[model samples]
Target: MTNKPDVSVLCFEGHKVRVLQLSGDPWFIAKDVCQALEIVNHRMALKALDHDEKGVNLTYTPGGQQLMRIVSESGFYKLIARSRKASTPNTFAHRFSNWVFREVIPSIRKHGAYGVPWALLHDFTRRSADSVERGSQAGKALVIRKIEKHQLAHEEKHLLDCFQPRLALGGESDAE
Candidate 1:
């Protein structure tokens, strides 16, 4: 039997970032996230992360089972933080960091899974919560409107909302 990957590909601008849901939160493919953050040597970058922050994931592809390197949310943040250290205050890293912090992560948390339509959730999250409410509901963990209502400070909220990770060898996979 073919095991369908429980992976979701989230596109940030032109970059395709693959996320795998495990435990209660999402784990991102290291290379995909590095590409999005413009980190050139992902290997060197991964080394700087804590042992808990990095690891491997087993996934399926047409060829069969594959081992992919993955990173916990904390690892993801470390990678982004590195970029910030290498850039100016208002550089691309800053803006992209904002988007990930404010939009992407929260969207993933609120939806449980991207239970909504794959192609449309991006637009839905981009638009007002009123519009998302108009769509169907499935495993809706949190309303977008509620996040707005709480208006929690970004870093503090996510740190409390998710985990603080011990995460192996990973190989690159197709964007899927």
Candidate 2:
């Protein structure tokens, strides 16, 4: 079994953030954390962490007041997305695929051929879409990967296949 760090909540610059500790387990107050950070909701929390550049800088408004929180899971999740978004999918895929392939896949491996099921993937994909709609480039590649992983053809071909039927119904060629 690979080493899995213990996840917990930590406070940085008055911001309630989650951390992965090597020792004992940690506690989390979802409501308290969200409120302290001044984020509109949990979705906002996910968005902020997803787009962080330098491991998420936690700054305070002079005299060390106010909050900006981030969670460890957010980092892991974003790593998956960043890996997917590079100039070539294969480049990032080789390095970061391990993030998902190592962490998530093993957790639900007991179900056999039907292991993990499509519902979970769908949930992740839906969240990926939400991240993209919220202008999260880190998650944009995740949405693309979600759809690409399921189709037998490449993205452009799949798009053509989808539009072909619509054009045929109107008795018009899709080339237009």
Candidate 3:
């Protein structure tokens, strides 16, 4: 059976970014994009298009002639959704931790921190709490060291909280 479309409505900045599927082509709507960036009018949205490394194409809004750039499906683009909390227990304390760290963190950093729900931070850090609480001094030091080395100072605290780190210790994994 075809799985139901995964959808999420995230309020970024002042906009409700609805991550939805339309015609099997996933799209985040234009109004939502503008809102996420806190651009009140079309001019600001157009200005932001120059920064789109993805060369995202735009579609006109009827009557307004304003365009919304869409990040089309491709190698780098992804669509994700939020689901209900799991009922059955799992070892992990978080759901989709990497995505939250990778995608949400940067966005939150770029935008002001006021609107995002604190629960997002909670969910992201939930899994790592045990590691933080129980790990040896060295282990905890490792977390701090990695944060200091890689992430920006502003991102350090959030990064440490949400860190799931699929990458292995010492920077190389055996599987690779």
Candidate 4:
């Protein structure tokens, strides 16, 4: 299995919130959590927080690694409380608070990870498998084209050897 860090994006009422698992605790990306709760000025909002915010390096797909400011679970609830007090409508904050308390936190407590329901996980797995299969097929075609043009038998072996790791992921079968 690929030793990738556990990072997940959750959607709350059309907002994308990014969460990271670090050292056995879940951390929320400050900006993302703020955005989900409709907090306009994240910097100002974070200032009212009683807990010290922390910065950590997280992998950003298609853009390499980035340093992100994050908040602990308690700090996250504190931000929610602050948001609920500050928001004019309060409905969004209430809804978000409910979802986190009823669903998100419970899942984390029980599963040791953000509990993505099985249906969602299954859909994600299916899509990921499709994408990987397509990529592997495309890669195989390109490798074949290159091998044909260069007539390099050893290079073909080396290329196939490089793909071995990906093939081991179980998305695609070995291509001879």
Which candidate comes out best when scored by TM-score? 4
**Candidate 2: regions farther than 4 A off:** 1-19, 22-47, 50-71, 82-87, 92-95, 102-104, 108-176
Give each model's whole-structure lDDT: 0.69, 0.42, 0.42, 0.71
After the best TM-score superposition of candidate 2, give how far the Cα of residue 123 lies from its true spot, in angstroms: 40
Task: Name model 4 segments beyond 4 Å from true.
Answer: 1-4, 85-90, 115-176
lDDT string for model 2 (83-120, tens) is: 32322444433433443356434542652121222334
Of 1 and 2, the candidate ahead on TM-score is: 1
Using TM-score as the yardstick, the better of models 1 and 4 is 4
Candidate 1 structure, TM-score to reference:
0.54
Per residue, candidate 1 scores C-alpha lDDT tens digits across 52-119 of 88888786433556787889889998898788533556655566677788787787689655433333
lDDT of the structure predicted as candidate 1: 0.69
Superposition error at 114 for model 2 (Å)? 21
Clashing pairs for model 4 are none
**Backbone collision count in every prediction?**
7, 0, 0, 0
Candidate 3 or 1, higher lDDT: 1
Cα lDDT over the full model 3: 0.42
Structural similarity to truth (TM-score) of each candidate: 0.54, 0.21, 0.25, 0.56
List the RMSD of every prediction in angstroms: 30.2, 22.7, 25.4, 17.5
Q: Tens-digit lDDT track for model 3 on 1-176?
A: 12333334555333355443434554455445444333357344444343442233333232333344444333112222211121123312123233344666576478623232324543545657756676777787989998877767658767655664533442556655
Order of candidate numbers by TM-score, starting with the best: 4, 1, 3, 2
